[model samples]
Target: MRDNYREELDDIRGCLVDMANSVGSQLSKATTALLDADVTLADLVIAADDQLDATRESIEQRCFTLLARQAPVATELRTVITAMRIASDFERMGDLAEHVAKVARMRFPDSAVPQEVRPVFLEAGHVAESLVTKAGTVIAKQDVEAALELEEDDDAMDRLHRQLFREVLSEDWPHGVETAIDITLLGRYYERFADHAVSVARRVVYLVTGEHRINAAG
Candidate 1:
């Protein structure tokens, strides 16, 4: 029974890693859909969100069951609890990707991103993807160092987000209010996606070290 419980815990950890990879893939496709104005691809990303939701539910149920049955303590308890929180972070990441896809669909055939700031969105996509990929590694290995590095990666996303605001708010900006709003929303989606990825990494760090890293605002 002890061996079986250990296997169950490992399985849950593996599921979290799989969920992280799925979120990364969704972001990649959403970025392509946004940049190219491909409604079909955008629709695919939007529709696939249901599967991510199901995965989150499955992870949560498994964690709850482990908690009720095995009564995990110390690091094992932290692992189970952190898995639930990380699952939630991954689900939110999926929603953010879906939001990006919806914007592409709304603007259909005309890229939501204008020519002047297309590069910013493109770079934001890259940073978001990189952060999630590293997050998966942190989950699988429980590497606190790699998890800490995600904080720096999140800073890159923050910089890109700020750059986007400057471009839209500049006096000489050409895009009108409607386009500016779309740009603002899209930048925020990417920025928040990176934030959640970092959040997942931080949870993993906590699971490994029992130390919580406070945000600047805290």
Candidate 2:
């Protein structure tokens, strides 16, 4: 029975890694859809959000069951609880990706990102993708050092987001208010996506080291 219980815990951890990977894939597709104005790809990303929701539910249920049945304590208890929180973060990340896709769909046949700031969105996409990928690695290995690196990776996303605002707010900006709104929204989506990824990593850091780093915005 002890061995079985341990296996169950390991399974839950594995599921977290899988969910992280799924979120990364969704963000990547949404970025492509946004940059290329591919409505078909955007629609696919929006539709696939349901599956991410289902995955989150399954992960939470398993965590709850373990808590109720095993009454895990100390590290084991932390593991179960952290899994639930990380799953929630993944769900939010997935939703942010969906939002990006929706914007692409709304401006179908024309890229939501204008030529002046297309590069900013593109770099933000790359940063977002890298953060999530490292997040998956952190979950899979519980490497506190790698988890720390995600914070640095998120800084890149923040920089890109700020750059985007500069482009929209420039005195000589050529885009209309509508396009500026789209750019603002898209930048926020990427920034928040990176935040969730960092949140997941911080959870892992706490799980491994028992050290909690508080985020002011969180």
Cα displacement (angstroms), candidate 2, residue 58, comes to: 0.5
Clashes of each: 0, 0
- C-alpha-based local distance difference test score of model 2: 0.90
Give model 1's clash tally. Answer: 0
RMSD of each: 1.3, 1.1
Q: Model 2 — which ten-residue stretch has the worst lDDT?
A: 209-218
Name the TM-score of candidate 2.
0.97
Report the lDDT tens digits of candidate 1 across residue range 4-92: 88999889989999999999999999999999999999999999999999999999999999999999898888888899999999999
- Give stretches of model 1 more than 4 Å off: 214-218
